[model samples]
Target: MALLHRAELRPSKLELLVPWLPGRPWFAGEAGAEVTRVAAYRFDDPAGEVGVETLLVRAGDGPVLQVPLTYRGAPLAGADEHLVGVIEHSVLGRRWAYDACGDPVYPPLLAAAVLADAGQAEEYFEVDGKREMRPASMTLTGSRTGRPVPTGPVSAGPVDSGGTVVRVGEVELAVVRQPVPADVPPAGGLTGTWPGQDEPVLLAYAR
Candidate 1:
């Protein structure tokens, strides 16, 4: 896996995030807040150019949060089955694939993403617990066609305190952001509860 830490994410990653950050649920900017990278990193699929990135952003009043992102060269061909929506990259002038929140890659990458933000071995280890999290099994059929769910394609699943979503094929695995009670220890050892771990509700993927 191509794991890129904060320093490696610079220039290139920053350029990608400039326009992408504002659209996120965690984005505090009502008028598109200015984003500065506090820390960042990336991981690449061993087989292909599909890459995932973990970014820590200092947006505004919100806690410095880790935002995990994935980059693909092109959209998955048969993704209509799991279609969520599209995110337009201002710099690239192209649209990209988004996937289900339960894409299986999230918890591990989320742990790695936490390490990218904390910048310490012990702090990084704290996220190891998250690596063990898996998506809850569901019995629902595909909403669009009411067909049995099929296996999805290569996907990017990003999880943070605000929420977590995975976009693959045409399905978006959405885990709504929930408020973490004062009793629970925060994920990633950041200031507050991480986005995905709180109360999660799945939303059908859309643009």
Candidate 2:
């Protein structure tokens, strides 16, 4: 389960994304655009050391964007290029956030999600030392040909079609940074669907 804390965050996630978005080649937002969170989902780290979450945000009426992030207690070694900045969490203290594609923990978990058809982990909140379950807003579906384990460091290529290729060893996982029309062919990697959506949104695919 993904545990959430009802604590304050300095320079909230949205605040960090505002400036960060413009620097991304795949971002289609206008300068000073307003962004709102539409939905989100989380993947549990088996070791419980990393916090993995994917945010779906809309920028000034533009298409929804997918931003997968990984929260780590300590800086991820050799991931300076992917750092999204640090933030102070009321409950967790300071955290280093990085683009999930560049983290070693993310690709393997993503592979498991796709190949095993794993659902997003259930969310929970801790109150007075008690845990309460919370509903997840999105569902993820994965392809059948995914490898069970990640083999090497991740390398990202240029963005295209609102997506980017994240290479983990021999596997190329297409990380979709924006939502496209449902009519787009599903090449079979990772897809997600949320409430009020007419069709499944493709998030990633293995090539």
Best by lDDT: 2
Q: Write the per-residue lDDT of candidate 1 for residues 1-207, one digit (tens) a residue.
A: 343222232235445555655665655542345566554434444354555545556554544545555555566565553333354544443444333233344433333222223221111211434432222121111122232232356354565645665554454443333222322122212223234434321212222
Best by TM-score: 2
What C-alpha lDDT, on a 0 to 100 scale, does residue 195 get in candidate 2?
86
Assess every candidate by TM-score.
0.40, 0.90
lDDT of each: 0.39, 0.80
- Writing each residue's lDDT as its tens digit, candidate 2 over 13-49 gives 9888887887888887665687788889899999999
**RMSD score of candidate 2 (Å):** 2.2
Candidate 1 — worst ten consecutive residues by lDDT sum? 134-143
